[model samples]
Target: MISLPEASLLALFLETLFYGVFFTCYWLTLGILLKKYGIQRDLLLPVATLLLCIATAHLIIDFVRALEAFVLNVDTIGADAYYSNLASPLGLAKTALYVTQPTVADSVLVWRCYVLNNRSLLVGIPGCIVLLANGAIGYYIVWCLSRTVAGTSIYTTIPGLITTFYILTMLISIVCTTHDDQDMTALISWRIWRSRRSISGGSADLLPVMIVIVEGGAIYATSVLALLLAFLTGSNGEYPAMDIGPPVVGIVFCLIILQVHFCVGNNPQPHSPSKSFTNLFGEQGEQNVGYGIEQMIEETDRSV
Candidate 1:
């Protein structure tokens, strides 16, 4: 029978394998996005290129560490020795990779937020600070672990801080995408009102893109929340979460970018004068109706 630690190692190996599969999918999707959208010339191209390199190197390190601790060393060394190996300098290097991947992913999100917000310093500066702080704390935790001979429990604040970082990122993303040239909630309300008043069956091409943005943020937020909860519980369950979370974060970001490329990049035509308002709302319907009165009434009702 497989012991708990052995099972944990097996789970880590499986998670690493799954991460490899996700990384492959990321590359394929990236290729398709670049081919179709010509995003290779965009700013995201270099960032994504760097991220891919890091992911490849990180995965290679992961497999090597797993092999050293679980397979290659298992026969010669005992279980304690196996776990102890994780505190060695090489093992510290492996643990530090978890921080590296997330930091890059967070940087991507921050850059996207900056771009989406028209490079607003108000948004970008705080994000940069938070990211830097998170990286510092993560490295400190890893450095502390590296000096120890046995694996030790990390600070609870670490996970909480990570959760905060992810929340901030999600908020920035939601604001940027939803407010990109228009408000998503307002657009959806307009659509529902228009549907109630008219019989149009056509939908906007950008609607799916917006929906994907929201869904992507939700997926990433959920994953981060799960990891935070796992850490909060102080159970070994956080191990699997740590194993799978980084790649999943990368995959989510790539998927969002790809969806945007497919939907927005393919249809680069400028909207007609009459359809400009419709494009802003990202829905297909008559644009003659005024939302000003309705918005005022809602605001007035809320105040009352």
Candidate 2:
């Protein structure tokens, strides 16, 4: 009914709580697997550290908004319209209003022109692009890894499931965008349109690849743009303080992500009934599998 009291902060809290649980589950399972294998054991801590920091930042944003609703009695500070407009590629003039930092002026300006100012993920269009890119890349890599390790595409029964889920998730995520059928169309871009189109049986793979391109590029692009801004604002060839927070967190994330990417390997797309680090790395993999499992479970719990 869209009648929830703004002061309730129900949706806000729920989203935070929901993602928290999801994030935790993902890491804990991953940790459990890692400890069991003992592969790159040292990385466990770094990966956890980076995730926690990012989670912290995310918490800060969510809690502040929640507090505002509870204390100031403001749901959005009347900034939704402004933010929506700023999220558009067409509203260049309006978007420029947010960048008041002189130190970040030039870098932010470039980003505005090339990346940030456009209708990227924050706007929902480009984020799809990134997701598709990941899907395609993830699929192909999985296929290749299967052949390398298992000598067949049917390496394991699970990779197919993972692949299926991956594709399905990508499709569902994009299709779920409700930018159309209401006042939201003005804010919608090709991604939202494509999402609707997919649900309506209008597209080939449900969501278009272009959506992934924009999405994956959006955040990293934002970070890159921010880093560039730091330099323009006289970073003295050093990472700026404001920028460090994200990069410190992001780089660690990237490393762990890459490591995991290779860890799972593209092997036969999946493995056998005994699929795991043990099969992948042998007795050595089994030695620390428990530790890896714990890290994964703990991470999942914390995220929850």
| Winner by lDDT | 1
C-alpha TM-scores of all predictions: 0.65, 0.28
TM-score, cand. 2 vs. native: 0.28
Write the residue-wise lDDT of candidate 2 on 88-127 in tens digits. 2322221121111111211211222223123244634444
Off by over 4 Å in 1: 1-7, 33-42, 84-86, 154-210, 213-215, 264-304
> How would you encode candidate 1's per-residue C-alpha lDDT over 1-304 as one tens digit per residue?
3443664576477567757766775776557445432222243445556555665666676567667766788788755466545456655765677677666766655544453344569867876787777677677767756665544445433556555544543443344321111122233334334532332335434444345445455555555566567656665555665666556656655664444333433333333333132321123332322121123222323334
Error of 1 at 56 (Å): 2.6
TM-score of 1: 0.65
For model 1, what is the C-alpha lDDT against the true structure?
0.50
lDDT of each: 0.50, 0.32
lDDT of 2 at 115: 30
In angstroms, how far off is 150's CA in candidate 1? 2.7
